[model samples]
Target chain A: MAIEVRVPTILRSYTGGAKVVEGSGDTLSGLIDDLDAKHNGLKGRLITPEGGLHRFVNIYLNDEDVRFLGALDAKVADGDSITILPAVAGGALGFAAAAALLGR
Target chain B: MTPGVPAVGTATPGRAKSHGNVRHVLTIDSAILDAIVAHARRDHPDEACGVVAGPAGSDLPTRLIPMDNAARSMTFYEFDSIEQLRVWREMDDNDEEPVIIYHSHTATEAYPSRTDISFAGEPGAHYLLVSTREPDSTEIRSFRIVDNVVTEEEVNIVDATVDA
Candidate 1:
């Protein structure tokens, strides 16, 4: 059995709108590379140019966050499932409009 | 009203064609809105964040899940990664989607800041903003942030009902 990867809406375009795709690898990084071979550009969205997981992306292996594990080095099994979600974040500061509103 | 997210009463279940074009006006329960405002007040001076989950493709927010701001800063708000994972999984198991992703501004108005626009990833979810800047009255607004573009939407608060 191949590893199953779940794609979130933002990155579905690379998967041809497929929510789940299959690939084979022994490690998380390898799995990503295998998937990228077919999806192309999917790796770049999940991994930064520095070869680390993107800060704005969250990858969970089964029910565990890979970040808390070994991240790219995390182990992957044939039946494992990977879920990729875009980080939900934001703020009200660090902007010219906000700074002006603050009278700064 | 946009094609994907037409005005209220025009959307049908299981017809959510696209994320960014999901909904136009937010028809929310008043009690839920009050709870969100209260959460913002309680977390004043620090940005509060949460999500409202609804049935998949329903665009109706029925479950409110308040999240811990990992940043815990007055200017920034981020969902705790672990918490986000758990909540998202729960939503997934329940076949629900994040209908409303809400956050608070301690000092600024109830609007999407440039930072907010930059980080908006859920094109289908309504971005709800609550400003607790003024202690006497709170300002709340809704917006659709898709592709770095922000469009303000109307907020229609209605009483909670058993059928809703």
Candidate 2:
């Protein structure tokens, strides 16, 4: 299945400045792997060595946060849109707090 | 909707100076601004969080909503999930959207941090930051965050009319 992914501006470098790209996978994790194959080092920026999503990265499936759904294991299908964004906050807030502020 | 402000993407580049310029201006009623400042001061040393809602797609902020800071830390703030969900649902039911998302910084300047830029999901909403570091003065700033690009904007505080 072809799933369209939206790349945030900060990570556009890995995608050669392409804002959106298509990848195939059955789960969110698989999708990342698929994209990483084409865009080297992309996965490293999103996922940590511990096999968990990086604290500073947030992945949203169809506008719903994957962390609230199933994280990297969240199911995906054709036409799904996955958005990757780094965890950012206004001022002193951290990743978790920033995510919470956005009501994710 | 703003009474005299033009909707974004509808304004012609050069013909509508007000429309073009207003895009970077956050117009808030003085009373509401004071309330937000009060909330920030009341939560001194801890971050205060809340939102201002207006008619959906209007780009006008008319309602003040003070949310509980679930994090309640001096350096961080988070809206209570359950409360956020309910508030969002209510806004949807009322055909309203969050036009302004605001929070306070207890010890820092009024600007978005890297984390804030990463977490900005609403391209149309204005992110307002209020710093309560100084006991005598509050520093407030507004910005538009789209795709992680943060652009500082001007804040125009309007006098609250009798009808308002």
Candidate 3:
């Protein structure tokens, strides 16, 4: 069985509105890469150019935060569920626009 | 509205059983409300964020913790990862939970933004927004954010101390 990855509403556009997608890999990074192969640009949004998870993006594996579980190096197996969410705080769109412009 | 969509006070499917099947109206202490407002005011222009922790299984918000917005930007807020880890660990040690996850909108009204709805990860916590847009008064509102759906709820500011 492939791992099930849950996509957040904000990033659903990249996945063609498919909430949950299946990918396979031995580790979290491998799974993300496998997903990106099918859904272009997804990995870029979740990972930084420096080869680390994006500061604003959080990836949870089976309700356990990946940060505390070795981040992208965390091991994965069949039937594991992954959840990706953007770190959000403060006001709504108005602030979001400003933050985007500020490159935050 | 969708024909079968649950109303504001109705419990959404998959809501944690510990919170019961119905959505309970959140009642916060007047002092706590004041403190949240004060924090927002103090951070004016920049959005302020924090959580009110309560005893585990109690659902009563009593401790007001004003956290630093790591982004420190007027438009965005991010809990410093290190600080978040420390606070969450402390809460676990104390057998507490973040009953209320709150933030301020320095310019917008007291409503969840699209981003807010998208980023709400705490399914069991009361998502509170305080609007400090007006100089004379602050507007505060509460909602339950589950599965990207935002449902506004009543905020009952009680006068007496919450039972421990």
Which candidate leads the pack in TM-score?
1
Q: Which candidate number has the best lDDT?
A: 1
TM-scores of the candidates are: 0.85, 0.63, 0.64
Indicate the residue-level lDDT of B46 in model 1.
Answer: 98
TM-score of 1: 0.85
Per-residue error (Å), model 1, residue B133? 1.0
Better of 1 and 2 by DockQ: 1
Candidate 3, A20-102: lDDT as tens digits:
89999999999999999999999998898989887557677876778889998999999999877646464555645745743
DockQ, each predicted model: 0.50, 0.23, 0.27
Considering summed lDDT, which 10 consecutive residues are worst modelled in model 2 chain B?
B12-21
Docking quality of model 3: it rates as acceptable
* Decoy 3 TM-score against native: 0.64
For model 3, residues B1-164, the per-residue Cα lDDT tens digits are 78965654455554333232235568788889999999999999988999999897677788988999877867667776556656765777898878899999888888988777756766778999999999999999999988778899888777655654
- Stretches off by above 4 angstroms in model 1 are A95-104, B1-22, B161-164
Instruction: Provide the TM-score of chain A alone for each candidate, in the order shown.
Output: 0.87, 0.84, 0.84
Please give, for residues B43-135, the per-residue lDDT of candidate 1 as tens digits.
Answer: 989999999998898777888898998878898888877889889889999999999999999988998988788778888899999999899
Calculate model 1's interface RMSD in Å.
2.5
Give the least accurate 10-residue stretch of model 3 chain B, judged by summed lDDT.
Answer: B13-22
